[model samples]
Target: MPDAKPAPAQALSAPQKALLKLGLTRDIDLALHLPLRYEDETRLVRLSDARDGQTVQVEGTVTHQEITLRPRRQLLVTLDDGSDTCTLRFFSFYPSHQKALAVGARVRVRGEVRGGFMGRTMMHPAFHAAGGELPDALTPVYPTSAQLPQAYLRKVVASGLARADLSETIPPELLGSLQRVVHGTWTLRDALRYLHHPGPDVSLDALEDRSHPAWQRLKAEELLAQQLSQLTAKRERDALRAPVLRTAPGGLHEQLLAVLPFALTGAQRRVGEEIARDLARPVPMHRLLQGDVGSGKTVVAALAAAIAIDS
Candidate 1:
């Protein structure tokens, strides 16, 4: 039978190319790219009730729109709800923005409200045509580059989350033990979903500080992965072979130890013997000698070097 040819690689879209630049080629990678912060767009507030310096979402009909070139070319739209009115200012905007905020168009806008002689104003606020059902959860703002729009990234992230395998990686027994310690029972999938779009009622402070149960679950998994990687590296190192480094009895190692003016501490003597034993093995030795300042580590190194030279 003839050998089969490999499948051709498909060309990537611009957004997909941007995602690759962010090292998010795998479904798991995209699933793990969590939001940097959240924006509250779950409810609409009356313009009269909205306070200065507060980030809020307001829905109103555009009463007027104009392009003024006095300070710089800018589009200004006046929005009026039944209670009050505010100005939506945009230094940079497109035809789509003009159409969305055209006179008599009902739109929903979100940004920090500012009060001055100009009355309540929102600079470069995000807006769209109103009349859709409000989201039940807070909107997530992710870390992204210029090429990826939030809408496109949100769709792709949702797709990735749905397709990625999120089965528990930790052993059931170990996971249970950690869960008890942290007083958390969130599963991996549950954690990711909640973190991506937490309910509006969830504590924002807890999420921001990473003290929420979902955050704890993710942290535990990350720590476990690091420890497992270290263990795997150690096991692989143990399997490798190396030249047996041995010195004859009462050779340079012993001679050096006997000639030292200061006697070795009980702790030093114990460690020195252990290093000597490791050097006599056929496998490579990986040992770290640690001590406080002035703990006689210099003499230990001298002894080890003597053994090596003699061998």
Candidate 2:
């Protein structure tokens, strides 16, 4: 069966939909929803650099469209952006996009450059089809998995983009002060809006505008959540009363250290503190140790074994 997304228990609110569409997740696992990396596609390169078949993204006008008489059933598109020109060939494409590639129209093409033909570079490439005209913007190439169709995934992002009333989880006073401190910064909402709808109006420069605070906010939230969880767990563990182990601390330790061939290292001192703490607790020591040969570990092991036997 296709991995059917479990039906939403209730109609998802707008914020929830955006999270789902981004593939942040279908379930509410906060940690997993964090973005892996921020992909910046702000710079548009020239065609001359593409001569040696470089993988690049550039805006070019369609000079020619020859759908027939080609043996491999590929699109022969002569593209130029006033500065330079290159040939884009798409081998086996959905015929549906044929009408969109009218001659003399401007489009943005992203793909790899192939070998030169008659001194001009060729780009036998896989590209996103531009509609109407090239969008003036930096496009976000989301982390995609093989299971999702690219077209369908784009549509899913569009549908989930409808903004619902959502809270800016950060304190309003802090957010406002930061915006005022940094003049001309995109508000948190604006960045998320463009992130979902990266089309003609949103420019590449705008995406990378240092003033955009979305990334900082998201990163801070994730870090704080993780730290809070760890602290809470530690507090819970500390609250449990531990049974005090009856052993002459320096007496046992001094004898063990003397038996070792080499003096104890700094790491051994710190680790000894930890293991000693765990052993003193009434609970069974479930310490998973990274032991090494001849690390004075034998002494520590003997002492722990003696604890169980003597108790």
Candidate 3:
């Protein structure tokens, strides 16, 4: 039988294109894109109980709505929760918004409430159809571009978090050591899930300051990955063969060290000798010479280069 042709790839949607622009092509990428902050939408507040300068979500019925031109064309909506009424103002709105927020429709709106000449008001608040069960966890507000809406991003991120392979890359023994250091027992998947949609009871301050167990786990993992990457690179370099660039007896390296204007410090001399020994070998040298400002690192480098040139 003849070999079958491969199926063609499907086109990406607008949201998918936006996700691609954000470098979120993989499920793992989406899972790792944590929220910038969280919003408490797990509970609702009465309109009467909401205070000025407080960000709150309230459910109410739209009693009256009108397009007023007094302040350069704005949509003014009066939302009544029976206890009190608040005005929902929108300077820039569409016909769809007017249709959705029609009079007598029950809606839940969230925004910072303010006291104005028009009584309690929320300027350009987010509103949706009311009566759905509130979320059990805080609403995560992720960093996003203009093309990608929060609703769409949240849905896709949840899907990615569920589908991504979250197996532990580090061994159990190493994880135990790290847990002891960080005093955290959270696994990679648990940390991600907790960070993505933290419970209402979790301390906001701890999360903000990165002192939470989940944050600690992520930090420890990131550091471990960086160390592993460096170790792998060093091992790969060590396996490669190179020309043995040895310093000959009384050659440029010796001449440079002997004739230098300033005397080499004990540390500098020790580092220089180490570099010399490494250069004499048949493998790549991967050593870093670190010192404070005004230290003799420059002299050590010059000495090493002299050995290289003589070889």
Give the winner by TM-score.
Answer: 3
Off by over 4 Å in 3: 1-9, 69-72, 173-184
Give the per-residue Cα lDDT of candidate 2 at 88.
66
Q: What is the TM-score of each candidate against the true structure?
A: 0.84, 0.56, 0.87
Q: Rank the candidates by lDDT, best first.
A: 3, 1, 2
lDDT of 2 by residue, 107-200 (tens): 7777766665454545455444454544455444545555554445454554444433334655766767655544535454554555554454
Off by over 4 Å in 1: 1-10, 247-277, 289-306
CA lDDT scores, all candidates in order? 0.91, 0.58, 0.92
Q: Tens digits of per-residue lDDT for model 1 on 117-156?
A: 9699999999888998999999988899999999999998
List clash counts for every candidate, in order.
0, 2, 0
Q: What is the lDDT of residue 131 in candidate 3?
A: 89
Q: State which candidate, 2 or 3, has the greater lDDT.
A: 3
Q: Judging by lDDT against the true structure, name the best candidate.
A: 3
What residue runs in model 2 are displaced by over 4 Å at the alpha carbon? 1-75, 79-85, 92-119, 122-137, 158-213, 240-244, 248-274, 281-302
Pairs clashing in candidate 3? none
**Candidate 3: residue 111 lDDT (0-100):** 95
